[model samples]
Target: MNSFSKLRFRQSIFAKFTFSFIIVGLIPLLALSYISLNTFSNYLERYAVTNFEQMLLFASKNVDDLYTRYNNESKLMYSYGTNKGQILGETIAAQTLEGDYRLTRTVDDFLQTVLYTDRHLQSVFFVFPNGAYQTVTKQNRTFDFRYQFPDREWGEVLQQNRNLLSYFPTHLDNYYLGSNQQVLTFGRNLLNVVNAPGVEGEIVGSLYMDVSMGAFDEIFQQMMLNSKDVVYVLDQNNRILYSSDRASIGQTYVQKDSNEYYRMQKDNANVAWKIVGELYKDELVMRTRKIINTIAIVVGLCIVSLILVAIWFSRRFSKPIRSITREMAKVESGNFDTQVTVQTADELGLLSRGFNKMVVRLQSYIEEVYVAQIKQKHAELNALKNQIRPHYLYNTLEVIRMSAVANDDNEVGDMILSLSHQLKYVLDYGQETVALQEEKTNIEQYFRLMELRYGEHKLSMDFRFEGDVLSCSLPKLSIQPIVENAIYHGIMPKSGKGTIRITAEELADNLLCVTVDDDGVGMTEETLHQVRQKLESSYSLDSGGSSIGLKNVHDRIVTLYGPDYGLEINSTKHIGTSVRMVIPLGEVNASAERHNS
Candidate 1:
């Protein structure tokens, strides 16, 4: 029964392969050729659509550029009047026919400069509030409005439209052109820079600019590179203002044909202009059909030959490929010991060798590179543990301090407590810096411990912090070392009671100045010079055996802030020693770790 079932399964596999080979070898060629042709046709349609849309966008931009320039020309005149406090000197409302010709001459010169500088400007006119008007034209510097339109009707129209940039519907041909051609008029209410009677930003007059339709002809010519393409400029009402087809001008463009077409339109309601472009889809399809047919024929032949080769290749290729596939699956499952056996010296055999080599290399990489990195990380953790070894001492001291407190040896308890607190603050390798207040608290605790160790009368201390000095930040244990040096070296060696004063004060240029001063047996000039040389040199100092001293403190400050922030010591033989530290007045939530060597 098992043998019969196996025989039937083999037969089913052969049947499936035969059906698949037939479909893949022959049917796909015809089906794909048909599909490719349809796909090509669809692509051609999209290409046409995209091209027309881009053309319309270009046309819109060109027209917009022209309109923007025209608007800016008139707006420049308005802007000048508003900015300069006058057209030339006199106000727009102040300028009149009855006024001196100087005002008119200045205004004419200004407008003439406008016409000369901007080639797109055809004319500029200012209609005063008193029904009087002045004009500057590009026709010539000598010619004025009267030379072009020798009538009061134009002036009256301009005067009536005082508050708006009116767009005139009439053609410029009657007034300025010898033939009938459409023109657009853009006008705006002119404003004064400094209003009379103290009313600033007041409307004073009207300004008008004319844009000829001839400018758009160049744009249309550029867009109509293909004979089948159509372009139109429409008003807000969809009435054609300009078209590539002369007959289509003033007529509505209706898309009614069954043939494929691409359409694009850009509309600006503020200017009431719409640029529309259309391309015939038949043109694109006709252009691509020959190429499509050629490719289809070549692809069909290639597919037929490839299918025949594929059948023979599949029979021979299946075994090694299956073996490689299984090995690769094992590799994907993280079994890097899996290896492919090279069966032949062909490309597949070379691939199998490469695959086996990759697995071996992967296993070696895991053992070498990854394991080394993990061990390096462990070493770093160990180093961190070594750096924080002081924490162990701190914990032991904490236990001793608690025991002293329990045994009612209150002074010993206090001393142990302060020592523990100081240890905890100093040995904390977690942060790189601390606030001035925290450092001050730690210093006070240290001072208390010192006073408890040495009688307070024998060594007294004073702290004075001025003007927000506590908000600033510095390296941890920065101030405490200076205070320790002052107490031990400066004050402890004195005969009578000595005073140690620590002051933190705000200084000029965003600097916080911390001074540790003591009235003790001051150092001799030679000793002071040696101390200064020690501070200036790369020598390290030790305080109370374990604590870092002046040089380390100075170098840490300089490292954390800058060179300008380190210690400066000044002393005289019989006078007290003063060590000043200057650092920038900014706060950061950081603490000192291991200092950079």
Candidate 2:
């Protein structure tokens, strides 16, 4: 062991700092630099190839979704458009414009419905051979067709391109917002023939649908997190489809490949679609170098001081009993203000300060450990109480008092009734949870009774809930007490109408949130700050609400669902107050409903 220790030679401050700076600074920069250049280049190559494959896959799915939506919407547009044409034809056949305005209102209504379905769609217009046109869609803010407007774009395209399906690349349009047309436009040829429908010379018109490129742009935005990374859409010839920066659109780039990134990418033809990402490895090494340099500079001076100390230490050790006694005497009287001002930066000076810090840390650690143990004991005791003793007795007593209600035993019944209500709440226990819908119902009944006792001057309750949210289970009586507090204390004290709106939303996480809000007198900053401090300090129900009632709800939520699911309160002056509970999608015991009042 001695030999091994000596193998690592005694390091001076200069040497130690050199090593430390290299370790902390130089290593990271170099590592990151290598990653950014070589490793990332290689990764990008592989990514490009893989993404090329993915692009095809994504395209297939995207095509299907787009086609289905477009086809459905287009068909509706065409059917209504064709019906208008037929009605117009029939009107002309019967010579009915002076008398043929029968289908005019129908045509107008159909066009309006088509226009209203999607806002982004520019227009759905019909063209005729005589260069006259009939457009039925709301093109912009303007309503109806541009009559006798020359059909140039659609007209020329129909003559040349015979394919029923055609796609146009990104191009600007001539109208208002449409002029800066960032769209993928689809044009299908519409035909009109005598008796049998024919898309011939009488190519009556076409269906025009423009889809915004915002979604594609959004996809690029999502992928490009770092400035070094870029997402590009390309045509078959590697011409750019679009870049986030408009200037880069239609431009091309030669990808730089490094490491296995290139090797992996070259073979995988679909790499373009995979979106391989890159990292700068050399930065870590470079950073390490910088740190080593700084440490060397600082430690070089420390080493010189250490050498001076070592020389002094050898000369001074024997004459130290009196000095040690004096230092100890200063320390004993609670004096950290005194310094151990010996002529050396060696053993005794280090030992003195080191011992002081050790004492501080030891005392702190002991206190922390003691507090933690107490908390654990309390939590275990609470858990034991949480699981034991159902609230069935309270439910039974309520039924007993109800029977007394039938027998007209008012005196004893009233006493039992009061106790039963209190017991039922206690017996339900803070650890228990009930269905959200059930709790709402219970709270509604409780609030209604409270209102009856207090009168309408207290507050207005805006209890609006969707039936869909009713099935969600929550801790029992969670909402009632919060509302009761607002009425008895917050709103009832104020003159104006205080509104409480209890709302629920099914969150994407599959958890449910119930928010109870009131527009009462609200609270001062002092109270809110107190609440925040209390929550941070300890896990107790004693922070917000009317103290006891809110404490009960908070305790019940936490016990039933763990720490993550609990109460949050927010309030504004004269505006309102809100209490929200986030409950997990978990099962409740069958006895919850049976034991309810």
- Measured by TM-score, the strongest candidate is 1
Global lDDT scores for all candidate models = 0.69, 0.54
Error of 1 at 87 (Å): 3.4
Question: What would the TM-scores of all predictions be?
Answer: 0.39, 0.32
lDDT tens string, model 1, 295-337? 8789878876777666665555666777888898998998887
Which stretches of model 2 miss by more than 4 angstroms?
1-64, 81-111, 135-153, 160-163, 175-184, 192-202, 225-242, 248-597
